[model samples]
Target chain A: MAEAQNDLKYLPLNDLHVELGGKMVPFAGYSMPVQYPMGVMKEHLHCRAQAGLFDVSHMGQVILRGCAYAELAEALEGIIPQDVVGLAEGRQRYGFFTEAEGGILDDLMFANRGDHIFMVVNAACKAEDLAHMRAMLPGIEVVEITDRALLALQGPQAEAVLAALMPATADMNFMDVAVMDWDGAELWISRSGYTGEDGFEISVPVAVAEAFARALLADARVAPIGLGARDSLRLEGGLCLYGHDIDTSTTPVEAGLAWAIQKVRRSGGAREGGFPGAVHILEQMTNGAPRKRVGLRPEGRAPMREGVELFASAEGGELIGHITSGGFGPTVEAPLAMGYVPAEMAAPGTVVYGELRGKRVAVTVTKLPFTPANFKR
Target chain B: MKYTEDHEWLSLDGDIVTVGITEHAATALGDVVFVELPEVGTMVSKGDEVAVIESVKAASDISAPLDGEIVEVNEAIVDAPSKVNEDPLGEAWFIKIKIDDVGAVNDYMDEDAYNDHIG
Candidate 1:
């Protein structure tokens, strides 16, 4: 199809996606490719079995400078629950922008790049996140890096492919960040990705992005993957999408993201009760959340999509919860979903029914990450 | 064989009309993961939703082209929905209906006309 309406922004790889026969669609206020000629199934499977390249330039990348890294980390901790002050140089941590009432503003990844902190936020939440950072920490500069294009090279062969060009990437552990120079072009490469695979997210200047993407695609191990496969891969990996699985109305504890909060940010720790939602979030951590996010596996073939209600039984069961994200898991070879239900019914083997097309289809509650995460530690 | 605007193809044999989705529809849908067919003996009017087909990315409704009673449903395709993608017009036929009015089949487009319409 033709690119979305003129109002939508285009990614740097838009033309290349079209040239590769990608089906373009409107996503997060941008015209993007949902899948290429191989379709989402093949693209998702390719990432699990081999390697896949993703154009994630739509995600917001920003640099926090004009202050010491330690001071910025403490200032940032006031909004997020993570122990940012303890983050080592060249290491990254995943956390969320939490509201005063304990609701998540947005999930983000921030790396302590020594001189400055490098942050990446979801595309849909970038504008507001940047504004929040600017308003919350007045003196520190939160500079949006719009001149860079981010690409994710993920899967079993991702390191091998990147090692061919930058041998230093092979030595880096998961969540390591390094600024490397290749052919005189500066690149910031992070050993992390949304997919549950060993990978790297490379931030290259827009001027050399096209050539860099082409060079990566030239590698036999890497195939161009689109947003469709990216969603499926993250879903199977049990990662939450910003708007669907986790949102402004959901808290980290309720969303089952309590693990992201290190001990330093919790009750009785050195830096406890300092973040925006510390009071309520720590309460939930000490006690328990009313609802918990859990994975759902359909017993049959019908794919349960977002907004499908969940029931406790197959015959006139009590309403339990609603599915937030659901689709066929290409790797699991079955339909999988994630949603929030009463904490009592959040066990892995709990039998629940998903209402599909006016019928109750049986499903089972399971632990997150339908597929085992293969992140290289 | 004839085709409807909705991309369903019908092959008439005596009073029973066999129905399946066209190749163009299958290609657009990518992979077929599930098929929910109407029960046999159910009466359906033209344009009524007679079946539901799901792919990894989306779910689609298969509509009836003519008023008819469902005489037979494709159990094999329901058991293994990939057949709809493998052979949409052959072994993947959805249902056979005893059409209420046989002359209604003439209203559908022939092969050449259907190809032109899609283009």
Candidate 2:
């Protein structure tokens, strides 16, 4: 843990990770656990079959408080591609901060609690995100929660385990939010996660973070998970990692995120544009982009990783595109990958070749979610 | 018995010494998630990384303790890498080799020497 510890600040549960016998590592600029005593494989299977608790305190938690929540929403809608203004109270939605050229800045999670919006951004991009938010929405009070700890309880059994601690949490549906009292401290729980399973991302004050973590882990079904299984689990779900899938070079349309940009934002009808990349985003929405992000399922046991070249199998391996994300899916029991190919070659069942270690391996452009996602409805 | 500072234990039988990662090395690598072993007949040189073993966070290369021709491999390690962590000395032996010199085993560190070398 000494060599793995980062100079960056740690969450309240940092000691707990050490107690759980985690092999800590530096990830996204934070010292986090890569695996626990059960190891990566066992932890991965546990998340799928049962529930796993993750300490994700490094992510940015912004509390937007002001009288003009609608005004703030409209302003946020300008920079991101999501239908934020149309979001109802107590609901969560996914969207991204776009670069001025329509490139994705970062993918983020937003929960609209009517009076204020509690937003969560990736750990790596928290600083840049805060600066971006401040630059775009002047006078809108946004407080970065540095003294808080975030935890994710994921998998099918996650609900039952969390329900035991916070009984009211059981009634919360998917992509919903609830302001609950956890041992007296306020906790913001979102019914969402990245592992393609039913789970909740909880934000608790640093003072009560450890107690909350232990309380949930008291249930037999819940186990403390690390970052290794977390990566494999999300990869199997076909979810895009911030740096890998959606980056500053990719646009919402190019990343297959056009659906996130509501029609109202594009048309400038009701709660019209104001965010950073709105102008370019609306243009992309009106006129289809040149290339869009699509999923790829390579036919072979070999895993296709990011930056692996993709080519047409017919033209003696003519260069088509490259893979962005890929891995061996434990659930699907096969290797899968995703990448941006030529629009014509992006269809599912389209035969493609992925060059790995210089050999062009056969691949198929198949539907995403190689494994069926059991997200709670 | 000779061993590399990397904690590989080599046992010499004639001009051959069985090579395997130490328990310390296996535990440090965490779970034995994936392994890429060299061909059985490939000629390996001293200090050449002939095998790739990956855990969740790090990947380790098993070096040839001394120059030798690979004679046999422990396929059970490939079947279940966790054995490397559980029984590194017994069932998780990586590969056996016909060494270039029977005396090379004397050059490697013994159990006490390796224990101190790691410290």
Candidate 3:
């Protein structure tokens, strides 16, 4: 165990997390805090009620720079299905790298940062994503940002807590990105987060990362949250976790992420279908995918977690689908799950059964985002 | 009180042995979200999985410690699973089984031994 722990990388705030009573565990090759002394349930509720601070430095941060913004965006359009060229400067959009087949390589958030394109991919898929981008975009510089640590301050009081430190934050709207000065350091701040709440994701220099985190936690409303609550928060928000919810085998259309695909990239539009797997992906968009991701609310309390098979009836039927991500939703105050099912059975009121411990439990197909998002439009 | 390596604590009174998970086990499990206990009068062999405990992170099962018939099951923890984390050794006692051989309790670890095992 000691030898294995040695192989895991530590975050910039590892000591701080340990001092705060965080239960450190191995995740994505990093020793990250899964929960703190307040536990997962309270941490999840705290994020929804007030504000929670998260250390998300393990995620990959990269800068794709070319001769100009247009060239960089055009080159990126060849890899992803999002409207990169049309993205306004100082704005971010949710997108994914697609494979030759119609499956997602990795879901990512990219911003048009005026001079260059900044992208953040999932931690586990960082190496592959970096390699893929470097291989695909020949002239573009796919530089990974290794000198910064990322932190997300999420919830209703997030803006208030952050704006207290930097007044300019109050003026930014959701998906808006800005390089603001804080304590003599340039902070890459974005009014965006995974939790279904108004928040900010700041990329701070590694030197001042801990200080910035401590400053935020000094607020009574801002508590230190860990990955456990982070998972439940995103799950409740209907956001996808890369490997679990959406993977190399799942397409953006089948994962219910069609909204992220702009019309400019879709069929019958200018700059239509230049990305990888454009033919199959466009076909799926024009017609429909065989299966689709949907929200599920299991009857009673037992959560139908990942790998639990779904059936058409309580007694027996061929396995229709399996849970991708699921757990007790603290904010929703019930057990909720997200999984892929046949498109015909993906309607909001459809009833499916998930086999739990050999017995089939009734699960109703519900709408995504078990809780309403409170974004600052 | 006797404890098993599995972290379950058993207290014997006459022929009925009251069972509950140790506080150490509860702490390790984090916050308990749901618990499904066995029904009363169910015959269970030693090491048979009898109860299910679901926490925020994952799920675990409690096994029958001895050959016995479940006499009573705690409904409180079932209604409020958080009680398992709050009072794991008190009100969160899972079941009371009427075992045929009361001497079986002597084979398990005592309080001090269980503490050393966890240590």
| Winner by lDDT | 3
Identify the superior model by TM-score, candidate 1 or candidate 3: 3
Standalone chain B TM-score for every prediction: 0.98, 0.93, 0.99
What's the lDDT for all of these models? 0.92, 0.81, 0.95
Model 3 residue A266 lDDT score: 95
Sort by lDDT, top down from the best: 3, 1, 2
- What's model 1's lDDT at A194? 92
Q: After superposition, how far is residue B31 of candidate 3 from its true place, in Å?
A: 0.8
Q: A1-377 in candidate 1: lDDT tens per residue?
A: 44448679999888898998989888998888888988888899999998999999999999998989989998998889998889999999999999989999999999999979999999999999999999998899999999999999999999999999889999999999999997779999999999999999999998889888888899988999988889889999999999999997888999999999999889989989788878899999999999999999998889999999999888795788899999989999888999999999998999888988888888899988999999989
Model 3 C-alpha RMSD to native: 0.8
DockQ of each: 0.74, 0.35, 0.86
**How does residue A311 of candidate 1 score in lDDT?**
90
What is model 3's DockQ versus the real complex?
Answer: 0.86
In model 1, the runs with Cα more than 4 Å from the true position are: A1-4
Residue-by-residue lDDT tens digits, candidate 3, A203-280: 999999999999999999999999999999999999999999898899988999989999999999899998998888
Task: Write candidate 2's Cα lDDT for B1-119 as tens digits.
Answer: 55688878877777778888888888777766556678899998887888877664455688888787998988787766668888888778888888877776787777788888888
Clashes of each: 0, 6, 0
